[model samples]
Target: MSGNIRSSLRGQRGMSYWSLIFYISGFALIILFASKLAPGYVDAMHVENGLKDLAEKGNIRDMNRGEIVRDLQTYFMLNNVRGEPTKSVQVIRGAEGMLVSIDYELRQPLIHNIDVVMKFNKQLNTAKPELCCEPLVDLEQYRKRD
Candidate 1:
């Protein structure tokens, strides 16, 4: 009987009940936070792709500023993005080509007063259509800044 007990105890190799619960709860929190933040990233991608298409494919050479703004607003509508695009988007037409500035921030509530802010800052030229901006590259480390 004592030998049987010793064998059973040796065979039991796993986490304790409390330890398992702690790890499971921690993982659950991470997943919950990720689910909340993933949509913001998706919206940013839509905006970035829209900018790329506008700079590369759209005929902005002959279009006026109003036309450009209207087109961009329509794109936002199609992508289900909130707020006015004009608030964050700026268009400059020079002798060379059009210069577009896309700077926007997405805010999501995490705790009571604490919120997560995702900023997307990018500049694109119609003459040079390349996506160079990396979203949240500067905020890789989470720390309070003064």
Candidate 2:
């Protein structure tokens, strides 16, 4: 009877240990997924808002550069929480017909506290650029500029 009680107690302890492990593993997986997907989700939102803002404020020829910049900043704030702008915007105006360029950055989430930069450029409708760029590349370059 004494041995049986000891075995039963040991079994309960073992089960408790396994339960703790299971909970920890589940938490880790959740964190991993959140870290991976959060950045992409935030970026997609920024791009969508940027495009909509651009379209609504149509006729780029008539749009005010400062207004556009303000719109972009507003969109970034509305969509992005993890990464946000930190630097004064660098607006490269046409010099000798040089195309205008805008650069911004976003600080994103990662397992090791990594950051991603987001960038957007309005240049001569050269090559008929895509209506929207992907979230990973230039999107990161134009994220919440810092």
Candidate 3:
């Protein structure tokens, strides 16, 4: 009877070891698959394209400042999950060209309470240069006016 009990115990140990290995392997597989599925540059791509479009159009020379901001705000609203403009798109009239700065946050995949902030800039309309880049409906300007 003792020998039989010892044999059962050994069998259970082997089963437990295999179970642990299986669990770990399963977890590793999930992580690997998730990493591949996740997109790390989704928001950055949006912001970059938006800025590029705005720059190409010449925010300083072609489009009005308010119109540029409104267009960019609308562009960002399309991809934002909260259905709101969570980013700041500013077209500053710079000495060399228009400086377009886009700042926004990207939600991380499969991770809770984490987000990535993407900021990018591009020069526009260098053909007609300005002395300094002026803000379009700047935050500080509005604050001071109020």
* Candidate maximizing lDDT: 1
Q: What's the candidate order when arranged by decreasing lDDT? A: 1, 3, 2
**lDDT of candidate 2 over 1-146, digit per residue (tens):** 99999998888775577889999999997988787666655665555556445554445545556765675677667766323331333333333221123334444555576645444333232112244332222334444664
Each prediction's TM-score versus the true structure:
0.75, 0.43, 0.45
lDDT of each: 0.71, 0.49, 0.52
Better of 1 and 3 by TM-score: 1
| Deviation from native of the Cα of residue 101 in model 2, angstroms | 6.4
lDDT of 1 by residue, 1-146 (tens): 99999999988977889999999999998997899899877777777777766776657677777877778778878888766334777667767776666677778898688889887776666666664333322322322432
Clashing pairs counted in every model: 0, 10, 2
| Candidate 1 C-alpha error for residue 134, in Å | 6.7
Model 3, residue 65: displacement in angstroms? Answer: 1.8
Ranking by TM-score: 1, 3, 2
Clashing pairs in 3: 93-133, 93-134
Best by TM-score: 1
- For residue 30, model 3's alpha carbon misses the true position, in angstroms, by 6.5
Model 3 alpha-carbon drift over 4 Å, by segment: 1-40, 58-60, 80-86, 104-146
- The whole-model C-alpha lDDT of candidate 2 against the native structure comes to 0.49
In terms of lDDT, model 1 sits at 0.71
